[model samples]
Target chain A: MVKFFHHALKFRKDVCIGCSHCMNECPTQAIRIHGGKAELTDNRCIDCGKCYMVCPVGAIIVEADDLSRIFDYTHRVALIPNILLGQFPEGVSISQICSVLMEAGFTHIFEVEHGTRVLEDAMTKMMEEKELPRPLISTFCPAIVRLIQVRFPMFTDNLMLLKAPLDIAAMYYRRKLEEEGISPEDTGVFYITPCAAKIAAIKSPVGEESSPITGVINMDFIYNKIYTKVKQGLSGKGSCCLPAMQPLQPEEMVWSLTEGEAARMPGRTLAIDEVSNVIEFLEKMENEEISDIDFLELRACDQSCAGGILTSGNRFFTVERLRKRAEEAARGNDSMIYDTAGDSIRDHFDYLNEHLKVTQIKPRAMDKLDEDMEQAMLKMRKVQEIMKDLPYVDCGICGSPTCNSLAEDIVQGKAHVNQCIYVQKRWEQEGKLQPKESMEILKEIWGEDKF
Target chain B: MAERMQFEYNVDGGNFTRAGFASSEIKKILKKLNVDIGIVKRTVVATYEGEVNIVAHAYSGTIYVDIDTERIRINLKDEGPGIPDIDQAMEEGYSTASSQVREMGFGAGMGLPNMKKNADEMHITSEVDKGTEVEIVMFLNNKE
Candidate 1:
């Protein structure tokens, strides 16, 4: 039985050209070319959105809730990350963005990073505990958390089982609304996400039973809507529904950038970004080659959330804009720009802290060939035996990501050993397989139209 | 009875950059075979320390890995100036490593002790002038 992992990335077979770009670039080798399309292994995909970035035909779509979903509740709140503010040009003020969100049918707006302030204190407390594992890994990036679960299962214990800023913020905001006499069903909290992994996390959270967030709108979609409104000089200034935007603290403003959490932690910490870099570092860490670190801030994207696949701005520019905003907040220059939103989250710190923890995240190891030890060992030998004839070129012509993966697939009964072009050539020369039969195999793997 | 899988990886002496290669390959194999994660962790730690010992102290070495349903057994054989005082070498802080090797973080004299701590069964054999051989076995069923 195959376990189903909810992925926000959806592949449209009609638009995929089977060019194999996504298969080649996937960090986990989760994609395989089949029937002239890219097929995703549900358990293997971490929903990092790397394939979405590399697709030439825009076939890979990040699933998002329809904007109309916000109208379902009486009190609609837009929970947005700080990186969303960095998407706009310097000319567009934060006030203008809030007004546009209000114009887009949201009754309230809240920054996700506000939850980090609450998390920072809890993290420091966690670091002070002598009994926990060394080098506690942050659970900020959903993609990195899922990556660790599927690829490096041993490190799952090292993950700090705390809610991410988005979750904390959502919980805080929902509680605030509840205190204001709004029923839970009447309040809808929609997160404007910068990546598919965030959507997946919201839909099928790893440790927690379910997310407090009611829906997710992709950052790119909201960015386009706000940018278009801003450009047309249609941002409703002084609208009656304008939210009293709270000025985020400097540290909170830059919490999603690289080294954001690591710099705030108590002890020696290292921040590594980009999926491939994280994988390399983790492999060494798993081998016990690296040790004695206090905390690890691992982000799937290069510049952290600024480099999210759904982000519209240039990653470097987004980082620069966010850093500038942080500096301005540090200087107290933004205090005059917006009014106080409401009671500070610190006022409810104790209540929020009580709900801050997530249950232990179970490791769903994708590398295991079988559940039974004996069967897995037998499959291992069969994969090795099949690998003997492979060219080891990792051409992806066999539809699997690498020659080794093809062998594993063959042993698992998902693929045939003859799918290898090298094996087909050898067999043809040996007069064992006819050329027409080999061509038929290619058609079966690649599709009839491909020929 | 399950069929056993055998693998051998060569480790070049003094190659710090490639010290974890054999252990990493073996780790991948154990993971694919659905071995208990605790067993995998201990096995890799022991293999890594042993591999690094060969790199920091030996001329050359080969790691022979044998895996069955019950347990994983690894033997590391290397040609080098072997341990004259095996008891002292197994001490936590005792060091025969050169100053250069210490600077590279390879030799803290914790190699043999770390292997012994992680492995369920460990054995050492050495000749004063010829070589050293270390064998470690970790059971798949019972975990520490």
Candidate 2:
């Protein structure tokens, strides 16, 4: 049955070494080893590019969106993600990067961080109103949001349901530019995104019917443009459009880290950072271990936005520097931005009602268990009975983690029982069954009688 | 086909390193049974929390798990120091854990509260000098 959305196109099969790097890193068990290849289950994929970022072979590449339409606009604006800050270390300042983008046929550069400020203000109001449910997970990363929608649907209500920082920034930018008499059709706002998930989010947001983003320009490609302009602007003071907003000094940049989202909001909330920690927290929340807390800020990456897989900075140094920078930029109190941004955008930004439409797709009925105590016991006995005859090396050369992981895989219809090494060896030793016969037996045990 | 399955786990309070073993085994068992992910996760968290509580707070105990068509029921009976105030323990961030337990990141005073959160229905009976018994029930329904 065709299931998951056509989001993750960066996954190239030839480059996948079956290292399970993507499997381990993926928030959902979407990518699994099926027939010795990294097979993604359409039902399981949230299109969160955690796998894309961590793949060693660069096997996964997010298909770049066609932003040629943005060139159609008389006034084009590039919204740069904060992680781009890590790319330009030695040569150019952020202002210089902004100057470069203007020279690159763009009219202006609006740092997406500006949207972060709006979100911060909105979150503060959200906290004060206490309108959101306990453990309000962040909705900044579309992949993470989709992860909740698909894998953790029960927790979907627990999510903030608000638009991400980039989208918030886009909303404000569009409205502000329109107010200045700039026609909405003539103004194109493209995000210089870190990952393809953002690009896909802009193209097709799951919760919302439409997205504020016009298009995406990959940060990897645009970093060179920023560099070229940095060199040219330094030599000759190039005439270019000046950005309306400035980088949040040094202290404000700390919002790039893992817990920065929660810290920015003027509220009493818990900010749990890191993917493992986020998983543990979600598991706890699902179990109902944590409640009554007003807000929950979760980022799949380790060190917030600065530590995103798309960035080039050393995670440790970037986090330390970003922390100091955020503190310095904010002038010690992080709430200043929220207090000063006024209430217009802040009030609207935090107002999120999911109103999501989802079809809870259960697996085919033949896969469903009897749920009988006797059947479960009978299955367990058969599993043990099968396990004893098989050697328990768990080499995974048998294509399973162990005789046990294989047993579970077989029972779950993820694998055939004959894949067990012991079963194969028994067929070899007993001479009663051929390899094909052994495979047929496996299929039969797993309820695949058609084999 | 509503069949009943019962399993018993011996939880030892003597060792901290061996904690979560029972829960992990049960997770494997549930996975093999092709139970729903929601049910498996809830059972894992509940059993793990209960097992950890037994080792951390109880003298020694046993967890009885009954799996049926309708629900998964776990009854944890322990001879450990009973809860002094169940009401206070239910609150978030409220804990009786010591500094040593805090060092291991195990005791944030979140154990009982976590258990209560995961289980659909929970009942606790305890005495300070005698022992503690916690019973939890989780329905297998797909909907919340």
Candidates in order have lDDT scores of 0.91, 0.65
TM-score of each: 0.98, 0.74
Per-residue error for A248 in candidate 2, Å, reads: 3.4
| DockQ list for all candidates | 0.85, 0.25
How many angstroms is the interface RMSD of candidate 1? 0.9
Once model 1 is optimally superposed onto the true structure by TM-score, how far is the C-alpha of residue B41 displaced, in angstroms? 0.4
Tens-place lDDT per residue, model 1, A73-108, is: 999999989899899888988888888898889998
**Which runs of model 1 end up more than 4 angstroms from their true locations?**
A2-4, A239-246, A340-342
Worst 10 residues of 2 chain A by lDDT: A352-361
